[model samples]
Every structure is written in structure tokens, then in C-alpha cells.
Target: MSRRSSRRSPAITSTSPCPCGLGETLGETLGECCGPLHAGSTTAATAERLMRSRYSAFAVADEAYLLRTWHPSTRPARVELDPAVRWTRLEVLGSTGGGALHAEGTVEFRAHLTDAGRADVLHERSRFTRVDGQWVYLDAL
Candidate 1:
């Protein structure tokens, strides 16, 4: 197995609320943060939570989590989250906005994965939204 995502600073603050924007409480987010593995984060803790959860969704093949955390309009009901893929690491390039109560935000991230023992990359520019006091992932480019 690869190094745990916790190798760095304990990704999520055991006390801060998650930044996935899924209308879930701190307790709920904590469960996810401590469970299944995901990608690493840099800079802000909220951004880390978002990145880590996305990785967890991928690791566990939790299509629902992926969709639920995803901003509705641009999100799909179901996706074939590949199970054979093994994610290596995540590099958060940059993040902007999405602060305060309700607003829009964007996160640019680089995800590295290994498929069939071959390395691959997913460089995406993702969008996010804070609705009803929750941050939900929108879509990625």
C-alpha cells in the first residue's frame, strides 16, 4: 500500500467541519475523514477535506457520495467509478473563493493514479458551491 494520506499534517482538523458542502454535520464529515483513504491536501484545511473526500469516494467506489457531494445541476445521478484504479497522490494546485455563507468557488487539482500498473494523470479544474451553509462540489474540467 502507498503512504497513508495522513503522512502530512492530520489532513482534516478533528474539530473543523468538512468542506465537502454536502449538508452533513461535523460528526458525519469526521466519520469520512477518518475512514477510507483519500488524497492529500495542502494550504487550507477545508480544501484538504474536499480533496480527501473525493479520494475516499474513489477508493470506496461510493458513487452516491460522489454525486451527493457534487453540486446538483452539473452532477450526474450515477457514474461508473472505476474500482480497478489505484490513486497515488493528490497535488492541490490552487483554490479560490467559496468563503463565508453562500458563494461559488473553484479548485484546481492534479490527481495521480496507477491503472494496470501504468501511471496516469487527471488534471482537473473543479467548481464548488456553498448552499444552505454547505459546500458541495460542482463539476471538473
Candidate 2:
């Protein structure tokens, strides 16, 4: 197992609401509703799922998982999570492709966040690619 897996944080509980606003209780604390993805399972089955998991990663400050799932072509050497920012909600506006047979996909979303008591929203259309049978975040479009 990798160091990331070994150091999995125990902050999230099984009954906690997913930070991505998936409306599902985290059955296991693996990724707080995206456990399978963060646990090194196969790529998310859909673009929306990948998007949600990524949002949850930001919410929980899982920089390792974010980097692991990012496409190598565009992935940065390091990811820095802002402790002062608190992610509040996620709204998946739409998605295209990103299925069992597709190699590429796009997900549009708006994430609500608060930083230093100031509320804000982040909107973007993200691209994704399947690499070696796993979904990886490419970039924002």
C-alpha cells in the first residue's frame, strides 16, 4: 500500500453527509462519500462522479488524493489546500461523455465556499481523461 493509503485520516465518519452534497451518508470514511475513488479503486464511472469526488477532496484537504487523480499531463508537482477556506456545497450543472466506453468527458459545476467569513462561488467546466482505466482530472475549460 502507498503512504497515502496508510495515512488515511479518520476525521470523516460513516454517517456524515458527503461534503460534495451528494445527499448520501459516507458508508465508509474512505473519501467521505467518494471512498472508492480515494481508496485507489477504478476510475469514477461518470464525469459527474469524478467531479463530486474532486470537490469532496478539496473540502477535506486531501491534497494527495487530488494529485493522484489528476492527469499527469497537467498535474502539478504539489497541491496546496487553504485551511482558511471552507467548502460549503457543490452543484453539478451538467456532464457529457465520461462513461465506460468513453475516454474523455466534461463536467460543469458550481462550488459554494466561504473564506474568512466571506461567501463565494466557483464555477467551471472541467475536463477529464481515462488513463490506464482510471479517470484523471485534466483541467478546467
Candidate 3:
């Protein structure tokens, strides 16, 4: 096995601070933040929140959550998460629309990660849409 697949990592704890950098000051835990979204117990009210939750899912390697929250129009048959990629941080740069009253929205962010011992960042402005009143990822701009 490759180095990344040789080790098993626990994703999150109820008390662990959120990986998406949310509550950076108040210190929000994953259980109190994205955990609910990941569990299907709740849905994001805004596009930005969905964006954060998506980042958190990547950090935790919750491929199911990622695929579930992806818009069907753009979703792939499967999402193959690389164990070698360790998502580290998220920075929400800006947003447009994607509110409760809007059907579409866009969020810009910088997702930092370490891949195979190399540090890199994925920066993009992502689009979101409401399908059946639930927020789902559409694509990147």
C-alpha cells in the first residue's frame, strides 16, 4: 500500500474544532457545525454555509456527503477521494446570491491541502443551486 493508505485516520470528534475554520474565534466543533450537515440532520441555509460544509467534508474524507451534496446535473458517477490528499484549511473569500430566497449562488474560496508531502491550494469560485429546496454544489467558475 502507498504511504497514505497505510494509516487509518479518525475523521472528527464531537468536541474537535471544525476543520473549515468556522468559529475561528468562538471555536466551533465539528459536531456543532458541519457534523449535522454531514449526518443529513440539517441542511445549509446559505450557499456559503454549504461551501464551508463541503470543505469540511473534504477534510474529513466524507465522500458520500460530498457526492450527496453535489448537484445531479454536474455530479459524477462516483467521487474517488485520494487518501494522499489531506485537506488542511479553508478561506471563504466572497459570495454572491445563494441566499434562502435565491435559487443560485456562488462562493469563492481557497482550499489548502497537503498532497503526497507537497503543500498546495485550490482556489476557485464555485456555483451552487437549490434542488428540491436543498443546497447542492454545481461547478467551479
Candidate 4:
């Protein structure tokens, strides 16, 4: 396994409620809640769902998942996450496209986090695209 896989934190469990606050219980493992994106079993059906899973990936420090769901054209070979940063909450502002019939979409949201005893919020509008039938993050707008 790579360092990123080896460092996969065990902070979240399957039974734990989704960190994205979607009021849905996780599956048998952290990958279950977002298994489609993580395991490639199926692509996220909607842009909003993709965005939620991405947020959950950050909360768990699953760099692998983040990379897997990222568009290859813009995806980096590897990702380095700040261990000190704790993603606390996600508030989705809105979304467009990335639906059953659309191949592209955009999701806007705010992510709340705390790092080194400092709390901060990240607001962004993210773009997504369908690559080989999977919705992958393209970039921030």
C-alpha cells in the first residue's frame, strides 16, 4: 500500500452518521457511504451527491478517495492533507447539472474546519465532469 493508504485514519466507522450531515448512516465501512466514488462500483448519480461524498472524504482524510474522484486532467498524482486540520461541517449552497442526463455540473458550498486551534471556513464553487461514466471533480470556480 502507498503511504496515503497506509495512513488511512480509523476515526469514522460504518455505523457513524455521515459527516456531511446528510442524515444517512454509513455503510459497513468508511468507504460504504461513498462506495460508488471510492470503489468505482457506480458513479455518483448527481453532482450534489458527488460533492457530499467529497466532503466526507476530506473529513476522513481519505486522500485516495479524493484523488479517485478527481478528474484526471486536473488531478494531481498525489495529495497531501494537513493532519492538524479537522473538517467540521459542510453546507452546500447549490448545484447545477451533473444529473442523470448531464455530463457536467457545479456545486457551491462552504466547508468549516479548524486547524492548529484556528477555525476557518472555505467557500468554493466546484466543477465536475463525467469521465468514463463517473462524476469526477474538475476544479473550483
Candidate 5:
């Protein structure tokens, strides 16, 4: 098994609300949503799905999934998420040209987190593109 597969994902249940905050909005649990994406059993069909799964990866500290979904041209050697910062919520503000028919797209979002009891938001408009017909994150705008 590869290092990514060997690494255990954070334990979550089928009924548990997804960290990406899609559970309440879309009625998708962790198991029914980002879990398969992170497990490599499925790939994101749209840029927004990729974006949301990346946020869920951050929330669960799954660096493997993050790196896997990143475009190789810009993918880092490794990802190190701050353990002190808890990703709490995701607010996808908007998106453009990220449909199933588009080759490139952008997603604007606000990720809310709390570090040492202090809350903060990281707002960014991120870019995505298809490589070999798979959606991958490119960069932030």
C-alpha cells in the first residue's frame, strides 16, 4: 500500500455531519460526501466538489487528500496543517466556469477556523483546472 493509503483518515461515522458544512446544506453525511473522494474511490465531478472536499481534508487534517487534489505543477512537497487551528466551517461564496463542461474554474470561499479560542476567516478565490479529465486545484487568486 502507498503512504497515502496507509495513513489512516480521521475516524468519522456515516451519520456524522461533514466538516465541509455540506451536511446541513445538502444533507450529505461524511460517508456520503467527502469520504469517498478522500479515499480515492471517486474523483470530484465538478470544481466546487473538489473545493469542498479540500476544505473537508483540512478540517480532518488529511494532507494526503489535499496534495492528491492539487495540480502537480503547483503541488507542494508536503502539506502541514496547524493542529491548533480547528477548521469549523466553510462558506462557498461563489464560483464561475467550474461546471462539468468547463476546463477551468474558480471558487470563492471563506473558511472559518478557531485557533487558541480566537476565531478567524481565510477568504480566498481559488482556481481549478482539469488534468487528464480530473479536476485539480491550481492556485488562489
Candidate 6:
């Protein structure tokens, strides 16, 4: 039988400072606010928060967080944000639209991961929307 990979790894140690700059450790930073998004702007701010949280989810394989923030239309029925998928970096190319209560925004990022001792790159241009006063992931290209 083929052996599938485990999707949850041991928690980060105190000695390890997080690469995302959220905190000294992974668990400590999951919900910690990093940029302006932490305070709540209703539009751009929430989008920013979602972006950061998604990255954090990728780093820790927090599938629950991913689903919670995803718009129902685009959210996958199920996701395997594998813990074995070693996240390497995150970058926000540009963002726009804080004018209306209901608005759209874009996030372009490059995610790096390693699987089976080999590396892979996932580059995406993602769309987000403000729904019911929260930012939700819509789709990714």
C-alpha cells in the first residue's frame, strides 16, 4: 500500500523564531496581527489580514483557518494544506479598492514548498472580496 503523508507536524519550538515575522514561534503568531489589517479597516485591512493568515495557514497546515476565510463559491470542498508542504516565502504584489463597503482586491504571491525531498514553486494571483464585513478568498489564478 502507498503511504500518504501526514498533514500536521509537531508544533514549532520557542527557540525558533517565525520566518513570517509574526512572532518568535509559529503557534504564538497564528492570530497575532502583523500589519494594518490587524486593527480592522473593513476593506483593505481585512484583505491584508486574510493574506497574512493564509500564509500562516500554509506554514502550519491550518486547513480550518483556510476554509473559514474562503468564500463559499471558490472554497474547495476539501483541502489538504499538507504540513509536509514546507512553505518558504510570501509577497504581496499589489492591492486596491477600499472605496465601497462591498469591494474586490488582488493578492499576488509566490509560495515555495518542498515535498519528497524536492522543491516546488506555486505562483498565484488571487482575488478576494468583502462579504458581510469580512474578507473572503474568492479564487486564485
RMSD of each: 9.7, 3.7, 3.5, 2.6, 2.7, 5.9
Residue-level lDDT for 32 in candidate 5 = 83
- lDDT per residue, candidate 6, 1-141, as tens digits? 112212323563223444354454345443343322322322235565477667755575556556767898887776765545677666556666533454787777676768766798777888888777678888875
Per-model TM-score, in order, reads 0.63, 0.83, 0.90, 0.86, 0.89, 0.69
Which clashing pairs does model 1 show?
21-135, 21-136, 71-137
What's the lDDT for all of these models? 0.56, 0.77, 0.85, 0.79, 0.86, 0.59
lDDT, residue 34, candidate 4: 63
| Tens digits of per-residue lDDT for model 5, 11-47 | 5455678988876788989878888998899999999
Q: In terms of TM-score, which candidate is strongest?
A: 3
Ranking by lDDT: 5, 3, 4, 2, 6, 1
Quote the positional error of residue 34 for candidate 3 in Å: 0.2
TM-score ranking from best candidate downward: 3, 5, 4, 2, 6, 1
Deviation from truth (RMSD, Å), model 5: 2.7
For the record, the alpha-carbon RMSD of candidate 1 to the native fold, in angstroms, is 9.7
User: Which regions of candidate 1 deviate over 4 angstroms?
Assistant: 1-48
Off by over 4 Å in 5: 1-14
Q: Flag the better candidate by lDDT, 2 or 6.
A: 2
Q: On TM-score, who's better, 4 or 5?
A: 5
Native-referenced Cα lDDT, model 6: 0.59
The top-ranked prediction according to lDDT is 5
Q: Where is the poorest 10-residue window by lDDT in model 2?
A: 1-10
User: Which tens-of-lDDT digit does each residue in 16-48 have in candidate 3?
Assistant: 788878845557788888889988999999999
